[model samples]
Target: MDIHGRQLQSAKQHQVFVNFRGDELRFGFVSHLVEALQRHQINVFIDKLERIGEDLTNLFVRIEESTIALVIFSRRYTESRWCLDELVKINQLTDQGLLKVIPIFFKVEPVTVKQLRGAFGDQFRDREWEYRCDKPRTERWRDALASVSCKIGLTFEKKSNESEFVKIIVKEVKKMVQPQENYVVVPFPGIRRRRDTSSHGRQCQEEQVVLSRESAVLVQENSKIANQIAVVSMRYMDIESENSVIRAQLGELSERLQSLNSIIEVVEGVVGKVPEIPEFLMNPWQIMSTSSQPITASADMFYYP
Candidate 1:
């Protein structure tokens, strides 16, 4: 499907996965950007893998198929091995022309990124010490950052606030998409004559027929992918629902167990405080209490007593 003039190349209908290091503000900012994209009818796939697990490799695989990656470059971001690994994979994918990476530098200087200094420096310190030299390591890091800067637009600012960052990012994406409105359709070469030659007209008709068939096929493929995504989403929802039910049941069971324990404790305390009594006769206290109650016994009760 095409939006405006730009082809919506995603196979899944409403999916975009966002991968970010564990920065609350960064995640919120990306979520806002996603909302903006959704407003434009773009499907986003978001990976909340942090909640699920910390296996960076698994996370990388999840990110590999995404159309675009938005990286939030904070001071702490470089410190995370998973984040760095993700960046490396992104760099690889971008080099292979498979995906686009957008870098949003939050409160981190471009110089710091370029130099791999400070937090970045610390992250790579082990490797640097392994090589027994800092200069080569720093140079390679600078080159990598420079390449990333050239390939992916980097926004460096002091503000780490999510809302402000989202606004800036949305504006930038808007500008990028603005020029694509005109590229949607290229007009067929203008025909000079009212009627084409018979042979040329037949060829043009055939070409038009072919184009129509291709368009239909593309639409069908898109529909199929959309259905698949829907199914996957539904499955995820079911799993989540099941998990919630299980959790609720577990909570109830825990409460019941606690209540049982409390009851047992109370029973044990009462039993411990009770005085011993002969099996065949009532205790003095019990007999006195019964006598004070103005007992009305039948002939059978008196005989039994």
Candidate 2:
């Protein structure tokens, strides 16, 4: 089956499957019951009015998928052959433990349905010959009726509040329904136990697991190394910025040295403008103690005289 078919086949799809007779119950009581069940958020599948004209094959399929079968044994239930077939199916599934049957004797006494007397008997009596040659089928239907009526179930009084009656049935169904699950479980093929694994296969799986862990560690280490490289690059950029500042400072210092050279040249030109001192005056102390000073002074006095 495809995914949709499998989903429809799940018992969880419809937790409560309702089976009832003709328009008398479906329009009157069953509608209220379905509404109450829906109000309580119960997933239910009920036969539509037009279901009488259409094919009922899918209805049985829905019945099979449901976990609970709610049989409404009204006055006209035994009159419908379709209803009898549904009841039989419900009984079979109940016997197999796949479905739970909750019978509601709607305005019909449990004794009436069980003994096939009163309203239930009159309805079946009219159609008795339809199943005379098929006694086994009629017997199946009777057995289904007996089994369902014997079960502990609720009864709707003729003049009582039907809303409250439906409430009781809804409560009972809710009590029996499993919790609704959001996810569907897809079936898997069967497998052997762990003990069936060969030693070599086990060793290979272990080695693969180790390799997976090592790969994760390697990825983490690579991330750390990349972060370190980024930090180093930022520091390098900062050092380059510092080197540019130093270069600018050096250029300013060179300009200041050139300005100092210009000031020294200006001072030397000012000194050159003043009178030149004789080399003998520069060595005056030594010149006074030598004979050169006296000879120079005698020549000077001779010239002046």
Whose lDDT is greatest here? 2
Deviation (Å) of 21 in candidate 1: 2.3
Q: How close is candidate 1 to the true structure, as a TM-score?
A: 0.45
Pick out the ten consecutive residues of candidate 1 with the lowest summed lDDT: 4-13
Model 2 lDDT tens row, 4-109: 5455446456789999996678778888888899999998988772356778867777788888999999888888988998988887776555678888888988
TM-score of each: 0.45, 0.54
Instruction: Estimate the Cα RMSD of every predicted model relative to the unseen true structure.
Output: 20.8, 38.3
Ten contiguous residues with the weakest lDDT in model 2: 183-192
> Which segments of candidate 2 are over 4 A away from where they belong?
1-12, 49-53, 178-305
Give all candidates' CA lDDT scores: 0.57, 0.75
Candidate 1 clashes between residue pairs 3 or more apart in a chain or in different chains: 5-184, 15-43, 15-44, 15-45, 16-44, 16-45, 17-45
